[model samples]
Target: MILQRPGRLAITLAIIVSLFLLLPLLAVVPVSFTPKRFLSLPEGEWSLRHYRALVENPAWGAGLWLSIRIGLISAALATTLATLFSLGMWMLRPRFGGVLMGVALLPMVAPPVVSALTLYFFLITLGQANDLVAYDTLAGVALAHTVMIAPFAVVLISVALAQVDRRIDLAARAMGAGVARRIFQVILPNIRFGLVSAFFLTFVLSWEEIAVTLFITSVDAVTLPRLMWMGLRDNIDPAIAAISVLLIVLVTLVAVSRALHAAWRGRKAG
Candidate 1:
């Protein structure tokens, strides 16, 4: 089957939609460089003071570092657990697998406020009992993020698992391969792309998580999103706009690089 190229009208509409979605975010670029202390577009002059504040302010640095650490930890934990659960469900095809999958997805489907409140009370209760994994601690926040994001990993990895040929598993078993070897060498290799997708998806979810983070953390584990929220609420600091611009640039770079790499691969294959 041959696919037709999009018509000029379709291309025009696509560009219009893209610009509509991106214009609001693009507005922050000038605000980030405003000479004024607050968030506003530059009047006549621009300054980098807000960008400098990201480096000079200890709170910003600490929040950024903490956010990176928590995102990494949550992504790792979510990916590992989701992989194991997805593998088990795919291989075993258990009776209650659908129910279990639904249970795993509750955090994602439930209202954010409900999930945040539930996690808040649970962590608060635990904090009263123990210091470790307590409310406002890094561990607690990371754990909350893991629970909230793991379902996404589960869905991605499960889709990857579904695409694998069952014959491969049977063939490996017929050759007297053990379960561990079959999984590590054969199954996992087949689903590597899914694993990567899940890892990055969960990492992004955890990185920008603010509702749950607001509930679970305070002084000690203030993540970048949480700090940005505080800045917006309390002072409407220009530094928040600076960070937003940086994130937008970073995401744009990654997206452009990936698109270029895919184009290069397609051309090579052609």
Candidate 2:
């Protein structure tokens, strides 16, 4: 009982710290329902006015659709490349692989400004900025997102690979399983969860990307974050609150669904 006291105190302190960070999120939920022209607490009434604007406004819808499309494309490309690289690295057991892994992690580790600046310079050197981003675009932002997100996928998939038994791979290779067959048959099936996790994570990261997108795009590739940014600067429209609310609800539902799925799988396995 005495030994557990410190642990209980630590857990309680952790929960307190978490709640402190989350208080702002909790406060935003009600403000999202406010019917006022400006942001404030709803004193007497609440309305769906802002939410209606989100649904009816063409700009919001367009931004959302574009974000989703780019997110999907970037996620697919990043996850596939990460999976292949992780599998290949494990197979090769290269001497300088640690250094390579560190280089791969630079995007995630470096400050946002550094990555943004790097991509900006890289873009200018390659082709016209208008063609890549502002004038009209899909490929530009999608490709940038893939590069920024690939490291996350690599780390996740590599962790999944590490959990696998090397003996299975060795046994397969001994039995004359070619490189491709060994990867597809032995390594991949065990890492399905990691692949799903990486895909979803990359999709979310791409969807929320702002710094790099801000540098690369002007109008043509305007994503939801950019739109919201413009709105904040221009109008601080009440609709922004409603969008926040919807995003919060959507992400919460997805999280809950994932948790339920994991629980069900655990039970099934047990």
Candidate 3:
């Protein structure tokens, strides 16, 4: 068990790496409280001015709201489509599953610039360009996010479905259960964790997305990250740091909560 031991060298190396990764974030958190309008290491006085400004600014608030709404819509659409497709692939074991999965994964694997250009051209050709139905609309942004995140959902859900015992399906069939009943009563309950994980992963991906969003959206449908980009161009402010801190905290809380829930459930089952 020497490998498991907290040897001095290993502990020192771990701490060093952890601090290296976290230093920027740690620096940002305090800067978010700086009294100065510009970003800097905190000086004589720390203040909540930046946070207050973020909350009070209409443009920032609007962008935040739009991002949240679009992220939720995109996550839901991606999760539903991915879950259904993954389930179908599992049930049928069609030869095309490999091809379909590969196609679905293209959005994630391809360079963002290439995908954005292709999608832009495709949208324009379909007569969606510059119209409400075309680029820059909230719906359009959501659709793009859905395409980007669905493959991740499909991958996670497929792994979960693979873990399921095939005999369970046979048992349900032997009991004369219809498709709907079997899915809801047996399959869904067993794969609940997978579904939840897929939902969270897809949601987080959409929420944090920037590259494709940048190419595909404009002022009307601008998201939080887009707004942050604008802020970067105009000025460096503590508000941007505050927003980044908020996002990091939110994602951390979500991940910890999911882990705790899974642990509690396992304990209960035992």
| Backbone atom clashes (below 3 Å) for every candidate | 0, 0, 0
Per-residue lDDT of model 3, residues 14-106, tens digit only: 999999998877778988888888888777888998888888988888988998898899889998998888888888899877898888788
Cα lDDT tens digits for candidate 1, 1-270: 999999999999999999999999999999999989887789999899999999999999899899999999999999999999999999899999889999988888999999999999999999998998879999999999999999999999999999999999999999999999999999999999999999999999999999888888878888999999999999999999999999999999999999999999999999
TM-score, predicted candidate 2 vs. hidden true structure = 0.88
Give the Cα-based TM-score of candidate 1 against the true structure.
0.97
TM-score of 3: 0.88
Cα deviation of 230 in candidate 3 (Å)? 1.0
Task: Residues 39-125, candidate 2: write the lDDT tens digits.
Answer: 888888988888888988999999999999999999999999999889879889899999888988888888888888777676665
Off by over 4 Å in 2: 1-18, 129-136
In model 3, residue pairs whose N, Cα or C atoms come closer than 3 Å (at least 3 residues apart or on different chains), thus clashing, are none
Which residue pairs show collisions in model 1?
none
RMSD of 1: 1.1
Compute each candidate's TM-score over C-alphas. Answer: 0.97, 0.88, 0.88
Off by over 4 Å in 3: 1-12, 125-132, 255-270
